[model samples]
Target chain A: MYIESQHNDRVREWARLKTRRGRQKSGLFLVEGERLVTELLASHVHLEALLYNAALDEPPDAVWNHPKSVDRRFVLSPQAFALIADTETPQGLIAVAAIPKVDPHYPSRVLVLDAVQDPGNVGTLIRSAEAFGFDEIVFGTGTVDPYSPKVVRASMGGLFRVRVIAADPARYLAAWRRRHAQGTIVATAADAAERCDRAALGEQLALVIGNEARGVSDALRALADRTVAIPMAGKAESLNAAMAGTILLYEAYRQAANGAT
Target chain B: MYIESQHNDRVREWARLKTRRGRQKSGLFLVEGERLVTELLASHVHLEALLYNAALDEPPDAVWNHPKSVDRRFVLSPQAFALIADTETPQGLIAVAAIPKVDPHYPSRVLVLDAVQDPGNVGTLIRSAEAFGFDEIVFGTGTVDPYSPKVVRASMGGLFRVRVIAADPARYLAAWRRRHAQGTIVATAADAAERCDRAALGEQLALVIGNEARGVSDALRALADRTVAIPMAGKAESLNAAMAGTILLYEAYRQAANGAT
Candidate 1:
């Protein structure tokens, strides 16, 4: 069936998923842009529907073969396309997909986010972790929702590539310490322990980043095996939390690549 | 002379400085939030004016006595404060400051940006450079203006602490090579040179980051002493440019901290 009406109930329902509450209720989120749609098709993600304007180019034939593909791909008018797209310049394509289920596993190289309220930061960190070879990201309480539109855009399709699970970071860290008994937990701090450059970051590590305003929670910090800092020579007090975590992730990659650690 | 009129010419002029053209013509830019204002006051930057509402707790006396005192300070109503602040929650303080003139110099450790257009990326890169001890940042053509409000806010006061100058990056790199005769010029590429982790990044280096879509310009790449990439194990095609640069910067910092060549 074609979704020709602007006030169509199904169309409005998909549009409403832009809100956090609506997305949670439906367990669905929207993806835009040709590149992102292409990525979603390549990944093992389930797409409920794909919408595009006839004027725009068609998506690849492979996109239609996904297990959850709906019967019809709607052709929206230019106006309808504009309404659906988050970007000012509509890419003329959008997909409604169920949020990928993330298993709450004790990942070997995990990223722990503590109250990183900016959706963009959360998203960029996920992208960086994926880029630098980290497998899983765990968001602590007070962090922004990973599925927010801003984060999904900022991540540049990283949302589909990484496992993102949410939990109370302090409790998770405590539990990991009690269970794993062998994994290393490194947290970034301004003035503590050895500098990150010189620290012995082992392969099985959990890196923790904290809130934009407050540093890592005291409980999380207390549970860390080491609190390392990126050394500074300039007047700036600290790096952005995302950048801080990226630096550490790359550092770990460097050590692993060189077989130094 | 306290001016209370909503239509006051000065108020109107200050409000207009929010735009790039307005900032260029007036040689002033807005810094909102108390933390940035405090940093601006402490730096050598010239404060054109300071505007705040009575609700804010008075800043420490030392903040106002910095050599660059505001030419004027206005206490406005909350409504007036909202008109000037970019943020929804006005921090009750905003200052207009003269753009600091950066002395263009070819330093041993410099960051060269090419068309990295995201204001947040530029800002965070500047912050990372400051944290990891890079000396100067040189923006190529097509790069976003570092002084834009969004960039300044994301920088977290790194703007005041770092030396940032703009230049045609391609020509600058070519000229620097001829002048220095032996400095290492490292450009990041997806499919070239050694992995960034194992590259022999030397003491005297200029790190170049490229556009978000195209990577580095062909001319700039040709000028590079070597091209390197951050090794990736995950399915991500590439790292965010700022994250890639931050990783490279911390690698440099690590090498330097260890006194390794």
Candidate 2:
């Protein structure tokens, strides 16, 4: 279908997906840019709609060939595309994908986000978590919506691969402790005595990352089996929350893969 | 001094420092919020001017007590303070500080950025570099200006602490190689066979982090003595540039401080 009017009901509805409330209500979120849209087509997630700007010479083969995955395809005029697009310069492609089902069962490696507020941080963590073999992501209270466009873009398609669940980390981790008796629940803190390099991260691990300003929440911190801090040589007070999380996750992966070496 | 108007000459000059060209011409940059402003005052760098929002109840103790460090101090009306601030809600304080001198001598460890465009990425890398003991940062041609407000803010005062030098990495590393013949220069690449965990990172090292979309630049990659890739366990194509750099820096620090294992 060709969409010329920005005010069309579908265009307005798609634009609403930009907001958290809208996405929660619609169970859909926007994925912009050609790379992300292409990745979406490859993933198991269901695509509700696909859009390409009319100005493009032609939609890429992924958009044109993927008829089975996408419920609807759109060739939108620039104005119509702009209405539903998040970027200043839309990549001439966008996709509306249904929010994938949250996996209730935990994976061997889980990344628990306590209240990581920055979308970029949340996205980067997700990307790193996926790259480092972290299979499950649990979003705790006050955490930014991982489905937000900024996060979806920043995840670089990693969002689709990982299993994400929204839960209160303290309560969930408490229950998680019973299921896997040997699992290590680690919280990252700046002042923790145990260096991440020295911490013995077991195979089944849940790493809890916290807010940018605040370290891991007290309740979650207390619940963690151990706290690991990345040893720093400089006097700078701390590392960025996301960078800290990514480094910790990498450390965990390295330990598990090759005994920390 | 009291400044009530946004059009005040000094206020306009301070506002101009928000842009790269303005900062370059004046050799000054703005640091926002009470925390960052406090950090600037604590650092050895000279403060050009200090502005505080009159409505902040009282200026922070660091601001009030540092009369010797500040060349000029002004209490600006809320509206005037807003003009020179980058954040939507001005933090009630901002400082104009002379750009600290870039140290010419190479340090034990260095982080070379090659066209890393995102300000947040650059800033996070700087913060992580400081935390992980990378003492020198060389901003390659095409890289974002480290003095930009966004980079400084994202750095969380790491910018104030590190030695930043602007130069082409290819040229700089070539010179560095001659000076320290035993030092190793490593470039991060997704496809590189050497795992970062296993890579033999010597005490003196330079890690080149590239642009968001591209890995290390071809010129710098060729200059690097060896290439290290953070081994991945999952399907993620690659980690965010900043996350990747931070992890590598942490790994290098881990090796130097506590042998890789």
Q: Best DockQ goes to which candidate?
A: 2
Cα lDDT for residue B202, candidate 2? 86
Worst 10 residues of 1 chain A by lDDT: A59-68
TM-score of 1: 0.84
Candidate 2 C-alpha lDDT tens digits along B72-103: 87899888888899999887888888998765
- Model 2 clashing residue pairs (backbone): none
**Model 2 docking grade:** medium
Interface RMSD, candidates in the order listed: 2.3, 1.8
Model 1 spans with C-alpha error above 4 angstroms: A4-16, A19-21, A52-72, A75-92, A105-107, A168-181, B2-27, B52-67, B74-93, B170-182, B235-237
lDDT of 2 by residue, A1-261 (tens): 898998999999999999999999999999999889878888888889888899889888856678754548888999999988999888898999999876568766789999899998898888888888887899999999989999998888989988889988888887778888989999988889999898788888989998888889888888888998888897536577777888888888898888643
lDDT of 1 at A199: 80
